[model samples]
Target: MPQSTPSVVTIGELLWDMLPDGKKPGGAPANFVYHAACNGVAATAVTAVGNDDLGRELVSLLSDNGVNVSAEVNDYPTGITSVSLDANGVPEYDVVRGVAWDHIAFTDEVRGLVEQADAICYGSIAAREPQGTRDAIYAMIDAARADAVRFFDINIRSGFVDKEVISRFLDGATILKINDEELPVVARLFGIDMPDESISGQQEVMRELRDRFGLDVIILTAGAAYSIVMGHDETSILPTPKVEVADTVGAGDSFSGAFLAYLLRGYDLATAHRRAVEVSAFVCTCSGAWPAYSDALKEEQA
Candidate 1:
């Protein structure tokens, strides 16, 4: 896998996760792109930032990390969210609405990139917005269907997702990734059997999704438990590596990014699953969603 070949295009929100300590540059798509870059996947992020200082900082961060920022916009002020941590260290966010990301207008350049993409990663959170960005992403999906592998990383944020949006994205996706809690919600919405309220039942739900949608892959994450990877021909489970948590912010996004990176490099489901879990563990050992030392740490783990 040569580093020069562009392997992925992640289209979605690019914002700052403002922790109590300070602001951390994040957004699911950006996090995925970060890990993809570490895995030698030539990745580009198509997102928008505001014309404000925060947006400028985000662009600088991306540039410093070796991520391509040519498609990132600076028309609107950058989006910001204040994150509050609980006693257990779980994060709760207060998202500022109508920010820069809400104005992600599609352009001829974005469409052209999508048409040339090898893989595309997006999520439902970015689609629940002022409608313009959502429309742009949907358009890109339609245009990229023939030549790209669309990965729907269903990062369902509270108050930022709806059934219609979820269904629409699922229909356009070639692969789907969701955390344990979201699997049942999506399965029941799609008229798939909810089955029993167990992890195996969730696996059954995923199997139904794969069979019904003809999806190439389905990834399910269960926090610090084991994660499941299922394809048409095989299934594999990998346990999360035991590590002291700094914060669980971008662990799932890291998993999604690493999984796609390995898959694109022609790794088997089992091996990819292990690598995804390992990278996610590395992320949890750090503070923010897009950790500063991600690439070097990942190389050490490898």
Candidate 2:
């Protein structure tokens, strides 16, 4: 058992995802930290929010969900993404630029938190435009313990991520969590030839990337199909649990959070991968990125 609670810090965007029904609190880092906190870790969200009603609501919601907010208040408006769900419940986002989260300021306090973290998760989207935010993210990653789990969830949002940013982030990542949709894109970007479309071929591609980046793990999640977790010597592949479709807003982020949480708590890789799958399935059945973890939900996971 851990001597104390495991610390997980996520530095990235924290914004409201404007859905068709209403605005839902959603962002990769926010959702990741929220799930990590819910799973009984000391999770902190190191991002920025606008000093506005929307920002206040976001902070309050995160606190209510058990995530510690180490957010900076900035002059710009809070970040918001207009989300449209397809018939299959997959989301297409029209993200707003120049928002508050795009202007995160690196502070000594954030550096301290990163230095002590057991795991840190960041993404490409948050570091896309703002040069300062990208620098801050790099600094925090540098400050983290050498043995820390540096999870880079390459959340390649449209019009945001490119080869340069993705390659730089991968350089520091111990674990790279990406979806099947993104795998091909990355493969093309890096000129890694993918001649076959079989599972073995996919694993080969993943292995090549892992070796190139010195990554310890590579998680390839195929929504509604299967997910593969590849470590240095072992690989665990599990079919995604079938559940009623809601919206896959933060399902992938939840998986990364749960996986890291279990690992930090001393669980074996297979067990951690299993639990992450279960948690991600539960999130897919809920409405927004963050569904209330009521007693029933807790029992289901148990």
Candidate 3:
């Protein structure tokens, strides 16, 4: 049901991740939009940045990498997160507060883009901030076409999400992307008690969530183990491929991006699920979230 070129828009934070070695461009929505564009979509990132050198460089980095950047220049300094990688390459973030992205505005241009977008992705991090930006994100989703793939990637960070906020986003989402680590949090937030923590138990929770929210699709990713995709009538489960890890900074975001990209291109559910797993596995072996596509990745998309 997509046009010739599926147009995708991601509305959320745009910031630099201060990793142990150095800084890199990151933010769930920005990373998602970048990977979506890499997989052959017209992808745009909508967020705010400071009127500073870092902000200009961040915008330029995204633009140079094929993502259309629609950023509001504001007075607050650009956002940054200190990322510390554990022994297994998992990341723990200390996110800076009161940054530029907390002040995202709803301009006419952003409204038009959202209205026409074939798919839109947003997360909880940016919406957890000052009230105006949260309202703006909701407005953008409300303006999207009724059939648009309103993807809600519940990127829950500490002190950023609660039951009320999660429920509000679920009420509007057509597709929900969650990971194993966040699944328990979501279950508790929704008051869905999980007596069994096995794979089947998780799928039951996913099914209940899908039915409750009237969601068309629900993707549950378990890092380094497996992933599951539950469609309206079918379910696809695939084990995660083993790969050497640089860091897991954006592997999950890459999975969401690649899955949506394949779906938009008319691939079947199973095939899309397989390709997304491959893409995320490839991302795991790379350094940052937006790595250059290797031949293996290109072939997987083809």
> Against the true structure, whose lDDT is highest?
3
Q: Please give the range of 10 consecutive residues that has the lowest summed lDDT in model 3.
A: 157-166
Alpha-carbon shift of residue 105 in model 3 (angstroms): 0.5
For model 2, what is the alpha-carbon lDDT of residue 27? Answer: 93
Better of 1 and 2 by lDDT: 2
User: How much lDDT does candidate 2 score?
Assistant: 0.89
Off by over 4 Å in 3: 1-3
For each candidate, give its TM-score against the true structure: 0.93, 0.97, 0.97
lDDT over C-alpha atoms for residue 293 of model 1 = 59
Stretches off by above 4 angstroms in model 2 are: 294-296, 300-302
lDDT for each candidate structure: 0.81, 0.89, 0.89
Question: RMSD, model 2, all Cα superposed?
Answer: 1.3
Q: Clash totals for all models, in order?
A: 4, 0, 0
TM-score of 1: 0.93
Better of 2 and 3 by lDDT: 3
lDDT, candidate 3, equals: 0.89
Q: Each candidate: RMSD to true structure? A: 2.0, 1.3, 1.2
Worst ten-residue run, lDDT, model 1? 293-302
**TM-score computed on alpha carbons, candidate 3:** 0.97
User: Model 1 off-target regions past 4 Å?
Assistant: 1-6, 71-75, 294-302
